[model samples]
Target: MSSRAFTAALACALLGLIASVAAAYVHYQLAVAPGYESFCDVNATLSCTQAYQSVYGRLLGVPVSVLGTGYFAGVLGLLLLGRRLDALASYLLVVALVGLAFVIYLAWATIFVLGTLCLLCLATYAAVVGLFFIAGAAASVPMIDLPSRLSRDLRRLSGSPAALVLCVLVIGATATSAAWFPADSTAAVQTPAERASQTAAQVDAEPPLTDDQKAQIRASFDQLPRLIVPADAPGASVVVVKFNDYMCPPCRQTFDLYKPIKAKWAQQAPGKVQFLTRDFPLEGECNASTPTGSHQASCEAAAAVRMARGAGKSDALEDWLFARQTSLTASIVKEGLQEVAGLSDFDARYPQVLALVKSDAALGASLGVSSTPTFFINGARIAGGMAPRIFDYLIEYELSKTAAPVPVQ
Candidate 1:
């Protein structure tokens, strides 16, 4: 039974490692590659992408999956060295217990706090739990004195130079891997100087658009069907409409990415560029197309913003909510609605407000918007976030065209 269980635990660890890798890769694709869809993003409520996009996906700036990957790999390594080690069962039990702690916390966060589920995460959790039970059941040492046995064996092993070197190597490897893992949502943000340097590197690599290229892009952009128009642009020659979700990571990134572009519009074109936003939260609570909901507060947050429109606090409302994306909850959103809009009639207005979000979502669906941060630049559709250069180029092109009228195709 002991041999069979150890074998099972090894298999579980391998499976867990694969799941961790999948989770890490999913988040990676979402960050650098726009419009990338995951097979596991079932909806807002049951999305792997949502959990990865949330703060819970990373711990202390390192991707949680990286830790998980290391953990499962360590388990396999320990088990492989089992025959050479004394009191292997005790070590396995102790290690399993340590990993179990993370599983419990992450499971709770996924269900209660983030209000989303990741299929790959669930698989990893199962593997961790299985390892705990298998190790405990197959323990050769006195199970009741696991800690004492583990401590004694660890001390014995530490006395050997070979074991000591191996321990140091493993520790160093885990730390170094975590420190160097590439992630967009690290705990420490980039300083302005760092950002500038990165921007300079990208600029040097990406050649500027020539006049002929710009003209071709313009001609093609004009021929694309215009499916959306701004609701509030009075004399604006160009309208930029975005279908955004407050809970989505890319949406927040895109919002920040557009700040400089928005600044350019204000400074150079003034009323020539008009920007608008529409709701397309991935949550099924408001979006019918989503079979399962993620982002529990998304619909409520949308309602709050809709209500804020009456008070002309919509922009402020967006800013406030987006800033708290990491910790947003339905109760928090509702409470904040009262605090910001401070409307006594917020609850009464909620149903209608939510309906407006639904309406916007329906429109987004008709326009083939499959993800958050979808854009419509004067009717030409873009399904995901764009590069900074392209965003600026399109806007500038439209501004240049404002001097003369061209009929819509």
Candidate 2:
């Protein structure tokens, strides 16, 4: 290969190095920091935290960015060797190809399985591709000579004690960094007394019962747990409270099932049908009901909606966040806040609403909620999720019990 190819590969390696370092920062912010928000989380489909928290983010319990940093450093060292390393072109080509393959695999996993995209990961992939194609195009060695050239390169490197030492140093540095790398994605189980409360947990619910199902639910209504909740509209015939985590798939399903029914009540019954929601993120950052980091982006989602309510943008923002629930991250929640609610100060403003979210989860815990999509239909607690028609049924049932309207003086 030409000398220019080595120089180009060196540039690509340097770019990759920068990307790896950035990735390390992202990993640390997500893994350790509580409620840390990055600028890269665009949605449920484009969250850096979600991508890093996934299986592909590490290799055999070691952070992948640490490994990547080592790879780029070794590449830089090899290229710096210049003419001292025999068959340098062949070595560059082989190394670049291997790196490219791994990059492609990560890309596939991130997009296909994880269903998300991270800007940092993309940057690394770009650098690796640049290195691979640049080295391949600039290779002067024929493909037939690759095996013998590789053999000669290895022998030459083995003969040079300094080159061998370089390899060992690169490896040792990588191992040392990996050993010291932070990976505390776990959230606190015992929330601070100030952070937690004895307040009832936002209770969570399921779909329309057939005749038999209706009969069964009604028969058991007398035996079901009574969930006391603050009514949104005093004297309202029916009140429905949903404790939801935006990133929970079942929660999203519950939202989808209830959307139209709630909309219909908003138009028809207005004040009579009161539909309320509470934030109950399964994530550890601001929620106590479940483990920390359980839902990576849920705290942000909760904060966004709560903030949106003040701006009269809750409906739009909530819909947008729920649509992207599975791929949410703090960054993604910030994006939704800006795009859906025109709240550009998401990072700054979200903290103000976090307390409310934590309080809601604390309340849900006291009320015996342990999962997302819990519901309280006028003091009746139902864990898990149910259908939309059930809300209508419950509303009708409550309506039958409501006192007749009192005449205004």
Candidate 3:
């Protein structure tokens, strides 16, 4: 390739590499930082946050964007070597083509399956395509000659097995290091409790809502059904409303965390705390607001829970469902309803139960709840799953409002 051509190729590769790195950084932020909105999160349909958090975001336990970052960096390094490393550049073109193929698959998934478009992801895809053309143009030599040229280069470099082995080891080590050290490592290392505490602290720092906002929130709250709290419970001055999906992993985690806390509230403050659970399934089968296939069994489970509630076994069925969240299926849900709640006639009540589930979902939508495990403590909204301590803080804050001020002597 001419010097000018090579320079242009290198420039394109460099630009593409930078974009890949940026996309990877955004993916890392979405994964580790709760409530972190990217500039690319333009709307419900064009949200980078939604696209990166989907099940397809990761491959083999590693984020795909992280892999893209390493791939682009390797391509950039090969491009910088110029025509002297033409054989390696040719090999990298094949690698870039493979990466491009994967990018195409991800693009298809983002559009048709996930029903969202992540601008950052599209930028990475554009980068991969650019790198493919740049590397292909720079390495004009035919693929059939790649092996011979590479072998000749290897022989000329250090005609020794030790040198080749060392080179291979270096490449492997570099790739492994890139895989291990993703962006924002500190965020990954923080415990869930610490992250939750930080999020709650941020929420707490916000100015108290104006009277109009509080009234609006309360009016929204009145649209939902009260959860089945203990009838004889104490002051019950604080209402804790949770918008949750039965199949959501975080919702299960939050439920388990709140178990003991709920128990403590029942023991200490009785009627003071009223915990209401509302359905917000992310499956389109029943929830029109959610994209299809987001949560496969959520709609079914929500309907089953509604039937269980009619059977006066809401808590028992919820406990069983949350415990086996990973294993939930239509059959399991039906079996649990029959066994846990002794609702052998659940099939007959399917229509009624589905209606109730849809009602709860509509209520959640009206409240602008787009995620699971969102909490409203006395009309104060807290989105996302939180640490038990944060829940305690919220409950106490609500309790304080109900406390009678001391009479001035």
Which candidate comes out best when scored by lDDT? 1
The lDDT-based order of candidates, best leading, equals 1, 2, 3
lDDT of 2 by residue, 1-409 (tens): 5567666777888989998988888787766653344567644345676678778889988888888989988888888764554456666778888998899899988876665678888888988898878877776777788788777777767887888889899999999988988864543221222111211111123333578766665667657777688655775777888888787545654565566677776786678888888888867789764553346778888888988888899987876775554356688788888887788887777677798899998988888877667788888998766545565666666665667532211
lDDT of 3 by residue, 151-228 (tens): 887666566565556556546754674576444322233344654565456555656555565555445545655433
lDDT on C-alpha atoms for all candidate structures: 0.75, 0.73, 0.68
Model 2 lDDT on a 0 to 1 scale: 0.73
**What would the TM-scores of all predictions be?**
0.60, 0.49, 0.60
Clashing pairs in model 3, backbone N/Cα/C closer than 3 A: 233-271, 234-270, 234-271, 234-272, 235-271, 236-271, 236-272
Compared with the true structure, model 2 gives a TM-score of 0.49
| Backbone N/Cα/C clashes per model | 5, 25, 7
User: What order do candidates take by TM-score, descending?
Assistant: 3, 1, 2
Residue 409 Cα positional deviation in candidate 3, in Å, after optimal superposition: 23
RMSD of each: 8.4, 16.9, 9.1
